[model samples]
Target: MLAATEKALEAEMNRLKLAVKTLQGEDKSEEIYIGSYLLARLEELGVTSMFGVPGDFNLGFLDLVEDHPTIDWVGNCNELNASYAADGYARVKQGSVGVLLTTFGVGELSAMNGMAGAFSEMVPMVHIAGVPSLRQQATKPMLHHTLGDGRFDAYIKAAEQFTYSQAILTNTVSAGAEIDRVLSDCVIKGRPVYITLPTDLAYAKISSDRLKIPLPRHPSPNNADVESFVIDEIVKQIAEADGDVVVIADACAIRHDAIDELKDLLYKTGYPVYCAPMGKSAIDETYERYGGIYVGSISRPEIKEKVESAKLILSIGSLKSDFNSGNFTYSIPTTRTIELHSHWTNIKYAEFPNIGMKQLLPKLTARLEGGKAKALQLEVPRFDAHVPQETDDIISQAWFWPRMSKFFEPKDVVIAETGTSSFGILDVPLPKDSVFLSQILWGSIGWTVGSTLGAALAAKDCNLNRTILFVGDGSLQLTVQELSTMLRKGLKPIIFVLNNSGYTIERFLHGKERKYNDIVNWKWTGLLEVLGDLDGTLSKSYTVNNKSELTELLENPKFAAAEVLQLVEVMMPKHDAPRALQVQAELSGKTNQYAL
Candidate 1:
């Protein structure tokens, strides 16, 4: 007892000594300002890359960033683009937070869309904005970029709606804690957080001991009682079911670390698991018990028939959204439906039954006697015959995905940019254990590029190899500033830019007659070369207009050594991709049916 007490006392003394050292040596107030301190905190948080477009208000901060070897400042053409890239980097790197710096008002507002998207998708990001100095705050006179009267509170309130949390740093003491709290929340909740730093505060000198970097607290699920009950109910239903049972895995199910557990459940039961479009590739495609897309127009007929015939529908982490349930076509009738989700279980609303997945999964596993069920046979439909000859002229998302699949190794992590490219990459067969991270719920473009950096960082920590990125031309241009980050860090990733010009997905939805579909054709190859810090060893660009050129570039030895390689100008027409074609066919069929 005496020895244990002495050891504990020694550990406490060591911690106190380290704390004192951190206060004395690390927090010394130099002539260097608050911006430097802010940069220091970012560096301490392991944020090596910052993406943004420098403006008059934030230029000082940018200069400070330039001098900091630990932090690399990247420039984008627009603030929104920078945010998107940062979002992508965060998703890829997992624990690494995204830092998006922009000037006040318009710059801050422009990036809000991306931040909101990150919030919805639960991507951890930090949005830092340079606001007008404290002296400029109370002036009733008109100010540039000011929304109603000159008060900044309205804009801050607007930001609050989109992020997990928001704060304005009027003074130094408030700045550190607020920044720490917001960043800590972002890490804990896995969502975007906002901080607005006043221009004047950037140059102010802060006291030494006041610099406190709080460790983040990760809270696990506290309420397990309800979850256990739901799991028991699900297991009872499954055991009683006579017909082949089907488990429809959704995005929420993918969370809560249930994949392996659910896979084990499937292996024992021999029940096929079908994922929704949003939940595509939830399980290994090679898994014999795996069934493909089920609800949308893209679903296989065999999978559809099985779903329709199932006596028991075991839905794990399923949201009964319009996109998932064929617009309510597959509503449960007399069938026993066990709906599992987060928080609550056995939820009944207006006569609909639903249960909590967290409760249901564990209990269900416990109740079941471990044994393999007989394999059930099912037929799958072929949609190739419906595809038209003209579709061949356009690059099929189907063809593109299979080829792209080859680039991903078992350990590689991929971030898919939003729009048609996102849909295209969703079906691609990834190697076992390969992670596909995306802001699917937010559908924010330009997020993948920045998220890729974060993913790459995460991959490095996991001892994983190269991080692969698939981005649309429209999205890539938005966050192209992050190229400097890749070069600065010496992180290599294969970037495939699907360059068909402006918002192709939106264009397809609006129809070809829309003049807004056009965008300024950026020379992506030239841009990467210029933006990259050329030590003559870091970056290279390749332009591939056709399959032959793409093949040649992939085969070249020079491509292997390049730290940042950009495959520019690969045209994929909107009409060719499966999702696009499906939509087109539906619209065309409606028109034809009405004409007849």
Candidate 2:
């Protein structure tokens, strides 16, 4: 009896010990200031780094950042560059949130362009800004950095346009909950969120016991029944169609993690599947049966004929916008057209037969299982196969891309800048499941370099290798400061910069008459070396002025080992005018009376 009692006592003591350890592990008992608490919540959300310029209002938060080991504050030349860097980091991090901090008024305002890009691309990020104290709200005293009447109203308005949610931490009591709410929404929605941390609240103590970190709600498809029925009807129409069937995927398709199932449906139906420009990396780019970019430079006469003859078009996760559809030339008949969308919100050009993709994709995949649908077998006629090779010119962007394409495997990521490099890479074939990221909708420059760093870090965690960035000389100079962060994190990315001396795309649009299109050129390789901490051991520059030199450099194994190899002075004649540039110019001229 004594033995049994002793054993029970021992077991109870062991349980108590474990409970104590678990409580000790939490360490949530510390009474930290509100700003500190907010920073702690950011850490919990897996944001290991922050990029921004510190100002008077945010200096206290910056001090807190210095003390924290988990979160590293990355300083940039300006707020605009910092925002771009944070956006780049978000794209590369893969499920981890990007954080950007800025002071009130101009500092926060400068980040709007980059934040808007994140919103358009659906990259998750948290943008935090420092504002004046809440106590001075009623008096409306002259706050430093305020625009008019001591208010930062414009910043809030700009943030509303780009973020999924916004919060203003007015006092110590509201800081913890507000930070938790904004971060939670960003994770759940897969979009950017904004929060304003008042300067006066930074040092105010908050009770740790009262702070409750609530679990975020996952939004599910609400009208499942209607969505399913619509999908079934659309699939039935496609199954009955005669000529051919083609599926064009968009950004939302990639966001839903439905690419694999979409691929399976396409393969089963034997229909050719093509991706919009923004949706290039949504599926395995190297899939043997994959079709090329359908709406951009790769769009050929044969492909257009197939699209026109197709009795039914399945646009899964597409917006059917002007750019995605090649200026609405490939309009679908109401009886034969089907659209799948993530949100049921009203979409533009909704005249065609449409339904939410969230409901459509799953039902279509299921119904098409065991049902027979004829395969699309259209011959793609090569336009340039017969052209004689030119020997004297500098390396064409088109020629360089194919060579670089060979280096990319199924797991590699390609981030292209918004210029000649982006247009050049659109035609380069990718391996299956390889990702391609760019600022498509917002059309921002200097995005690719920073985004590549973030992507490399994310890829490293997944055991994926090789995050490549291709940027123009003009774009690289805009946000080159982020190279320090990449070096600090020990991220090795092969940055292939096309050393064009100007904004080639803008010059192409403006007919080379605009002197503003040209940029003061830099020796890119030397600049990168100067910025980062390399002991001169990194792979360096190979200036290729002609096609022969480029070919030789690509073949050399030594080129790969170099940490940052800037292919300097590669002259590409604004020869092949990108189709998108032409369209954009026409659209701009048509929409704006003054441009005419």
Candidate 3:
């Protein structure tokens, strides 16, 4: 009996010894740190670069990112720009997530607006914040970055409103699971997520076992009954249609990673493919069945007549924001419409739940493999930028856009700002493999400055063509500091600053002549030198006031082929606006008049 009791006592002592060893951090040699694990998961998801501004709290986490071989840390000028950069990164690379690293309270709060915009537009981004240690939180010490009220949850509570999932890793034991869960939420939902990792927890040891398993990013849900019913209803609508069946693809088609399936569906059915303004460049525009862009009231006459008169409209991944739908001018009837979304499908008035685009698209494409092609009545207008133009005229809004058409090449990632830049580019057809990113739904000015940095990085990763940015002066002023970051990174993009003087979109909205729509003028071309430390090696900026100068710059072979950062400020009339913008603004004004 004594021998057995002694054996049990020895076992208890050994267990206690191990417990003490773990407490003293002696047994962590075989374990992986949470920082390394988080990066590994991100690398597994193909994150080649992370964008953020470094701060005292997040320096430790940044160290791990720096040490990682697969991912590079892109330092931004500020947290807001970093968040916008992440949004742009996600938009360029389909099915890949963007990560933004920042510090606690001040850092996270400053990035809220940019992340909120991502949430509104369904871009998946991870906003990882380095916060005060759990020990500091428990002691309730007043922190420099905190609000000093001792309640540490205020920033997180604010984030909860914008983020799809918010996780605080106070306990290292649950860090791996928590990180996986939050990132999964971001990817699966296509929205930004907030993850607060305490400064102490960055180096915390977690089991390496979880790293062996892949985190589920895309969760496919299949309700056989619902899908069957949904597919049957969709096929029947097309069959009973009197006119040609047309498709209206939108931004979510790219967000939901359904481009390939969409291509297959269009190919098999021989349906004419048209993109909503948000979904511009979602498909290969060079394809034979490619139709023009459809923005309802703002659509070109031929395109509008074809779409409105369609017998059945297959709207895929459609997010019908007012701007996307041409100020709510869509006239397609519910009885003749079928909508396919990432989460659900609506056939006319009936919506079937639990049917996701990623899963249903493939099945639907297979069903339509031998389906009949629609006989389109009208042909989309052919686009050509080489049209005749006067030699010595001042560049106007009418002349600038078509002139830009010849400037674009295949594989270019075009980013347009919220004002004149965004609306003007709507009329220009993108080249093959090109992308169009704009904050039409969110309408945040100055977003393109930071997004240009991200889109350039992503474009380099994919070996795509140039990164082009179009922003008005007022919008550029809001986030122009990011130019320094772009110069520092040695990325080359053609940045066109519409020198229309001020907030052209806002002027179009309400204040055409109000002081609120005007802004202080700066030497726009001199900015590149100022931001680039006056070094010609970093970038070249120019200001063009007339048509000849702009055309001359476009025709310069050296400028066209140069790998240096190029900035061109195109001067135009202050009162000029795109036709679409003018019409939409007028309609919106009348709509608001009823409220007044």
Best model number under lDDT: 3
Worst 10 residues of 1 by lDDT: 379-388
Better of 1 and 2 by TM-score: 2
| Per-residue lDDT of model 3, residues 456-477, tens digit only | 8998988889999999999999
Clashing pairs in 3: none
Worst 10 residues of 2 by lDDT: 379-388
- How much is the lDDT of residue 153 in candidate 1? 74
lDDT of 2 by residue, 1-596 (tens): 22222333453454454344434443355687887777777776667778888899889989999789888776776777777767766665654688889998879888888888888878778898987777765567777687657665668888998999998777654555666667767765678999987778888877564234332423333354665556556655755765356677777776544465577676666566667777877756555446666663236556556655667767766644444555455545655566665554222234323243443454566667554334635443232212126676656654567667766667677888886766666666777667778776777888776676667666765676577788887888878877766776677777776766778777665556677877887776576567765675544555677777767776667565435433344555543444455554455445443543
**Scored by CA lDDT, what does every candidate get?**
0.64, 0.66, 0.83
Residue 133 local lDDT, model 3: 88
Report the error of model 2 at residue 401, Å.
2.3
Please tell me which predicted candidate would have the highest TM-score against the true structure. Answer: 3
By TM-score, is 1 or 3 better? 3
- Report the candidate with higher TM-score, 2 versus 3: 3
Q: What is the lDDT of candidate 1?
A: 0.64
